[model samples]
Target: MNKKTQLGVPLSAQNRLFVPVLGASGGCGRSTTAGLLACFLAAVGSSVVLDTAPRLTSPWPSWPTEHGAGLASVPPGRPLTRHQAHAAASRSDGPAGKWSVLTDHQDWSHGPLDLPTDPAAWYQLAATGAWQAVVADTCHPVAHDIVAARTKGQRGLTAAWCALPFAVPVLCAPTSGTGVAALQTAVKAITAEGLPLQRMVVVLTATGEGRTPPVVKAAATMLESQVSAVLQMPFDPHIRVHGLSDADRLARQTVAVGSALVSAVLASAHHTWGDPLPPAPVPAVLSRTAVDSRSARPAHHEGVFT
Candidate 1:
């Protein structure tokens, strides 16, 4: 048998939460948020873990040099097969019941690339036994195969077999109306399955802490209607210290900001809506349509050209 924990709750029961750190676009602190959340969970003896995926937006370093841990990037593009993903998850090391991290490469632009399809081996591996709380940092166009597996896998199966690992879409809080319109479009795609908008959490970034513009407030208000939760975090000063030499400072900074986000997640996990919900089942109207309209919306950078 694999190393067992004291609770013996089994991997699935133990890993009640599956967090996918997503942002409206890249460079909006999605990766940093994932890394820091892992550290915070570990510090609190929660057996935390963070898994990354193959994405074109951000570069994956060999190790989490900044935080002084084992936050490594997985191989990107086509090479990330199902067999490879399962093997990596099985091989990782962590406290018996604390946490585990894994990553896969499934390009989003191509359309749903199922885990059972890529290598077809993971479907079985996940059923057997594996890590708890698998946090996958997904690629853009969020509705991909890997994400589908993590969110809405076949029910009545083992955690490895079933999907629905608490999917959180990280949205960059835009300052302009145009940005908000684009976000609305993405929300529609995420909630299309009717899997409970609560499964989605929007992480708002780039407001630079302390000062939030009116457009930012409006955007958050609009998204709150579409998902379970909305969180706000400014461009943390700590991320500026990249590279191994700045590890200490970076780790400290990550821990500080990451902890707050984690608390919100834990709190939101058990509760219903704290604020008025956003418009459910957003109509098929997104920023593309907004562009045609002459609304004085905020201007935000759209990540990923495709």
Candidate 2:
């Protein structure tokens, strides 16, 4: 890959980007795509990954963390602060750059968490952190949501996020006959909702090591005309064996695909919002005294505001 290709969008306090990795169905490599996007985007600016999967199914809690509270640590009633949001996330630094991850860390034996279902809530939580880039590993059935929203004449999370000026949604599907069929259905549903199909990027992930399937090839050819870009994410042996604990171990091709995904998202954003994208809305700032008071409390008591 060219050196320029590896370079990511330059982000700063003045602007931020949100990339929501929307999966077509279960086991479609949504989390992996989100993680890779965060890793590459971190190369240019501060990045974070929000795992929106349920507590029991989420893999982020299993990753290493130091003094982190995970998503369960976020307060429900009040607005979140950048300090509090960062405190809740697990930080990691490596060849890919520095990034933080926030997800459910509650034990399986515990009851289900009251996670926010509205897309705006998730976007608000991300914006509170003042991050340069955010990759949300969304778990909702995007096609169903879009179709339901249309039926009810209400904007769903997928549509609402795509409507954002700074957001770029990625649809993930496996490279199989069934997956391709689901992807096509999802594309139609999104189109029906009147969302910008041209701004959406579709990622066809390889499930195993093998030649590209004919079904996937055909689907890609069909999707190229319907969406912004169709990307092929090759299977990585390291991910198959060890999961996404270490991004540095990903295959060269896999890393290149991640870089390309970032580029495509940036291109889409620029195309939609113009060359100089609109400045990011500044998050609320807390008083220095209040911040100090909050920091003085024990880490275990983070979510409980006095």
Candidate 3:
């Protein structure tokens, strides 16, 4: 058995609301989740997406940033705002809602070569005090950032823990036995470190099929005991293909999961940081061409995002 607090324990809020969509690896739909969450939050209020996952990149296009600076181009520890990263952000397409995004850049010399190497730098970025909410897609397990700090010759702080004070880590688990096993492993690892679990949300992303796998169902049920909440995001073929292109249609597809996620996030925000502004609704332009013959059709799989 793992150590955990009663469900109602308070998770100290930081200066911002950071919803980090994290998972076992690159293929677990972390990027898609982060992007969509940002969009949803933008619909309710201003939001930003920090894409630090190692392999995945956001499909949204970049808007013109102030003075043309990328993450790496900005001096480490130098204050940065969402506007500064706008050059690196994907502009919100109409009807999808407007949200700023800071993802890895194209040029090797320009943006960060990898995830934030310095924990302090990560802190600076997180503490920048921008946006009403932030959704970060992390490639590695939440614990990996601690190891990164030592490698950078920095001590005491790791990216994950540094941001924990302000973040509600959404652990995206696939609906597979391997996914369950991975979640179990991660839970155990983080528990051993004694990191608080009260703010964590276990999101089980399932593929579209006849039935949910028995093992995955069992795993999701089991996970309910270890974290704040467990959410299921059914597979949507549109997100699998378009990756959050049409927000209006996607919202309709993922209403249940989206509403649930927003509620959980707002509750978490209230607990952690006190009276954060609510997410604003951004009207989305609907597209007729988004749907095709595929069974998955057009959808948001909202839990992966919202």
lDDT of 2 at 202: 91
lDDT of each: 0.41, 0.77, 0.55
State TM-scores per candidate.
0.53, 0.87, 0.69
Tens digit of per-residue lDDT, candidate 2, span 1-306: 433235644665667788889988777899888888888887767888987778778777775434378777787744456688888888765455768898877778988778877666676677777677888888888888888877898778887777554888899999998898888889888887788888888999999999999989988998898888899999999988877787767788988898888888888888888766778764333344445564422222122222
lDDT of 3 by residue, 1-306 (tens): 111121122222223466867675435666666766666565454577765644234443332122133344433323333344444445554233566666555553444354564333443353443355667665555545444544575442323443544667777778777777877776765675555566777777765645788998888787777777888777877666666655555645465676566567667667665664333222121122322221222222110010
> On lDDT, who's better, 1 or 3?
3
Descending-TM-score candidate ranking: 2, 3, 1
RMSD of each: 15.4, 5.2, 14.3
**Model 1 lDDT tens row, 1-306:** 333322222323324344556544445555655655554444333333333344333333333322222212222222232333333442222222223344333344643222222211321222122333334444443334325545765421122211443333334434445555556655664465444455456666553445777876877887676666676655556554452122245544344455566556554544543222221211111133343463323322210000
Candidate 2 to native Cα RMSD, angstroms: 5.2
Q: Is candidate 1 or candidate 3 better by TM-score?
A: 3
TM-score of 1: 0.53
Best by lDDT: 2
TM-score: which candidate is best? 2
Q: List candidate 2 stretches off by more than 4 Å.
A: 1-9, 64-67, 283-306
Candidate 1: worst 10 consecutive residues by lDDT?
277-286
